[model samples]
Target: MPGGLALDTILPSEIKERLSRGEQLTIIDVREDEEVAAGTIPGAKHIPLGQLPERHTEIPQAEEVILVCRSGNRSGRALGYLESLGYKGLKNMTGGMLEWED
Candidate 1:
């Protein structure tokens, strides 16, 4: 993840646990194309940070939404934006792929 994470965040393990229980999840990856080429959480929808403002409609209004990025930086910002747009269940994946890659 980034050097310092803000208040709202989620851990990869917690996401994994919910998935294990067969819960429906909406995961959005806000990483850039080049960053996404490396890999991303399975089932995540790719909506680059730059495109989120315009494409936010494409994202489902699920009660829970997991936002991911390379180091959680972009995703964190995305989460905040989504919140302003009336998204209630948005969460930034803490550490992003950095911690998940571990």
Candidate 2:
């Protein structure tokens, strides 16, 4: 991650606060369809980790993208990939959905 956008972890509480303030942010749930069917944060977009490479262009280039998954690991990986692709303001939701609903 040297000289690159190191993966950043943001707490769910922080996400909530920023949204409450009406900040326009993008939350990308990297979980598969089955897991996402259970639930996802309000306003989050679904882009399974497996399909990310082909569909990465679907994500807006100018927006900050926050990634989420069953746990933080997958999303962290997604963050690394996206960062490598030159996406900025990218972050992983620390603890992922597990912490978000806890």
TM-score of every model versus the real structure:
0.86, 0.87
The candidate scoring highest on TM-score is 2
> Once model 2 is optimally superposed onto the true structure by TM-score, how far is the C-alpha of residue 13 displaced, in angstroms?
0.7
lDDT of predicted model 1: 0.86
- lDDT computed for candidate 2: 0.88
What lDDT does the true structure give each of the candidates?
0.86, 0.88
Sequence-dependent TM-score of model 1: 0.86
List, residue by residue over 1-102, the lDDT tens digit for candidate 1: 468545577898888888889887899999889988999887889999999879999987657789999888888899889988888878889888998888
Model 2: per-residue Cα lDDT over 1-102, one tens digit each: 357434477888889899999987789999999999999998999999999999999887766789999878999999999989998888898888998888
**Model 1 residue 9 distance off true place after TM-score fit, in angstroms:** 1.8
Give me candidate 2's TM-score against the actual structure: 0.87
- Could you tally the backbone clashes for each prediction? 1, 0
- Per-residue lDDT value at 98 in model 1: 91
Best lDDT among the predictions, by candidate number: 2
